[model samples]
Target: MNEIAVGAHAPDFTLTTDSGDVLSLAACRGRKLVLYFYPKAGTSGCTVEAHDFNRLKADFDAAETRVVGISPDPDKALAKFRLKQGLTFDLAGDETHAMLEAYGVWGEKSMYGHKYMGVERTTVLIDRDGKIARIWPKVKVAGHADEVLAAAQAL
Candidate 1:
């Protein structure tokens, strides 16, 4: 898969959010977006990452950016995770992995020397023009939301 580069037009997608509303990238065309992909829902790292983004959601809104998280988890799991974590942002289901492939964040991963295919922790900052502004691949959860918020504010 070719990695999406900065300044490239973000691929458009429509996925079901935890709220049961369909969210389309085209609908966010004129707004800055913080589209993040995580490996799973309700896990430690994923939980922290979602909470971090949720905690700073107001700041993101102030910066004119909308944050959305995507995972390969089913919509039910996404809904439960969002409710349990008190996340205010959208948690979208990508069970088909189409969005994952389009964003090039799903690939080989290793844990304890065992290889597996999964969604990499990635955050892509899309400018209001709908172009990729920044990409954070293999993201570290701690302080990552702040970093992405800073980038969004810069945009």
Candidate 2:
């Protein structure tokens, strides 16, 4: 799959959310969507990212933007992570990697001299018309949510 570019249509998907509800990108039309992809649940980087997003949920809501996290973890794992982290936003499960592939975040990664197939820390901001507004690829955990918030606000 090709990486989604700004001004292109965001690939829509329907996935089971951590709250046991079906979440589709198309369903979130008419609002800015912050779709973030992380490597795994409960990991140090993932946790900090989730927490940061959680902390800014109110601000995002005020900006009329919706935030959703995506990873290959199952719903059960997402539930535990959400509860443990006190996350207020939705976490969607992408166990089949369809969404990840569509967004072009699932790819080769290396850690500690070992290579593996995993999610690249990435975030996509979709405009109200469902077009990709901005993309943050190879994201650093620090101050990421704030950056996303600024982008969403600008859109």
C-alpha RMSD for every candidate: 0.8, 0.8
lDDT of 2 by residue, 1-155 (tens): 55899999999899999999989988999999999999999999999999999999999999999999999999999999999989999999898999899999998889899998999999999999999999999999899999999989888
Count of backbone clashes, every candidate in sequence:
0, 0
Query: Candidate 1, overall lDDT?
Result: 0.93
List per-prediction Cα lDDT, in the order shown.
0.93, 0.94
Worst 10 residues of 2 by lDDT: 1-10
Which segments of model 2 are wrong by more than 4 Å? none
- Candidate 1 — which pairs collide? none
Q: Roughly what TM-score does model 1 have, to 2 decimal places?
A: 0.97
User: What value does the lDDT take at residue 26 in candidate 1?
Assistant: 88
Off by over 4 Å in 1: none
TM-score computed on alpha carbons, candidate 2 = 0.97
